[model samples]
Target: MKRAVIYYSLTGNTMKTAELVAERCGADLIRIDMVKPMPEGFKKQIMYGGMLATFGKKPEITGIPDNITAYDDIILGTPVWASTFAPALRTLFTKKDIGDKVSAVFTLSGSGDNTKCLKKLSKFCPNIKNSVSLSDENNGKPQDNKGLLEDFIKKISY
Candidate 1:
């Protein structure tokens, strides 16, 4: 099956996981880049200024692939922000009609509740067949947990 792993990463953690997932599944990888990088102190702002933006929904992605329909499977990866999927992903979810495609979501965070994030993503993509989460300990770096990720890819790719 033709599959693709698309993700947005702020601290490189999610990108690392995306690469591994793509390699394991033999899927193409796409990186969602913000036109302007968030300010260096944006994390502080997200905390004090109310994480409303982050937790509310996904933000708009500037350069989404025009031919997303070509892929049979999509694996979305993101970092946990304010206990939810990053704002950028919420934006991507705005585009509907993905019902026939297979989908999965994965998250990487230093510390946060991944269950809530996955649940929220499920709402956006109701057809998601499987989902997974990886903490800082298992993210990016090589480890014995590769088997876990490979299993997830196999589960969703078909």
Candidate 2:
């Protein structure tokens, strides 16, 4: 399958995980960048960005491929915010018809709580084949959860 990994990262963890997924799956890497940056600082970020995601607010994003049909399967990744996905991803999904094309979903959660996040994403991406989440300590570092990532990829890609 022609797979693509589309993701957004604020602190590099999601980006690192996305890179690994792309490399291992031999998928295209499409990074989502916001036209305007979010607020800095943890509290500010959680309050501002998190609320935006919670409220289903789509931020202005750049770098979303104009043609999303180039890939047969797509894997989405983002850092968890307010028990949900990033606003940038919300923008992409809202603007694009990515429901049936999504093959899998992955997330980087600092608090290790992503059940609701996964459910919310699954709502928009109904055809997902698999899903996984890595905690703060394990999200970026391959050594921490390589086995888990491999298992996730195997279930979907292989």
Candidate 3:
């Protein structure tokens, strides 16, 4: 299948997961960046970034890959914020259409539940074929979740 992994990562955890998933699936990996990037300090990340997520603010984004319609499947990757997918996803969704595509959503969290996150993803990609959540070890590093990622690959792949 022609697949693409579109993702946003603030602290590298989600980026790592995205890389592994893309390599395993032989999918194009595209990273989404907010026009105004978040603060770098830990406290600021929580204060500013978390606040945006908490309020469901979809900040402006740039570098959205073009020609996504050419891919058969789209994998949306995000880092958990306020227990849900990051707000940047909203901006992306507003810019593109995934209605006729087979898609999946994956998240990297710091021991936070992804129930709400998955629900939000469905609003954008109703036909989401699978969802995966990988927890980070508080130190901001993603825990090993190769098995979970592989299963997601199987669910989305032909």
Best by TM-score: 2
lDDT (tens digit, per residue) of candidate 1 on 6-124 = 88888788899899888877888978755555667866646732354554744456767887767877888888876777777666666645534637888886552488777767777
lDDT of 1: 0.71
Ranking by TM-score: 2, 3, 1
Candidate closest to the true structure, highest lDDT: 2
Models 1 onward score TM values of 0.78, 0.90, 0.87
**Per-residue lDDT of 1-158 in model 3, one digit per residue for the tens?**
67888889988989988898888788899888889978878999999988888887879988776777678788888998887778887777777775346378789887735888888777777887788888875645545567777787788666
Angstrom error at residue 7, model 2 = 0.4
User: What local lDDT score does residue 132 receive in model 1, on the 0 to 100 scale?
Assistant: 73
Is candidate 1 or 3 superior in TM-score? Answer: 3
lDDT of 3 at 16: 89
Off by over 4 Å in 2: 138-144
| Every candidate's lDDT | 0.71, 0.84, 0.80
Positional deviation of residue 107's Cα in model 1 after best superposition, in angstroms: 0.9
Better of 1 and 2 by TM-score: 2
Residue 37 of model 3 has an lDDT of 73
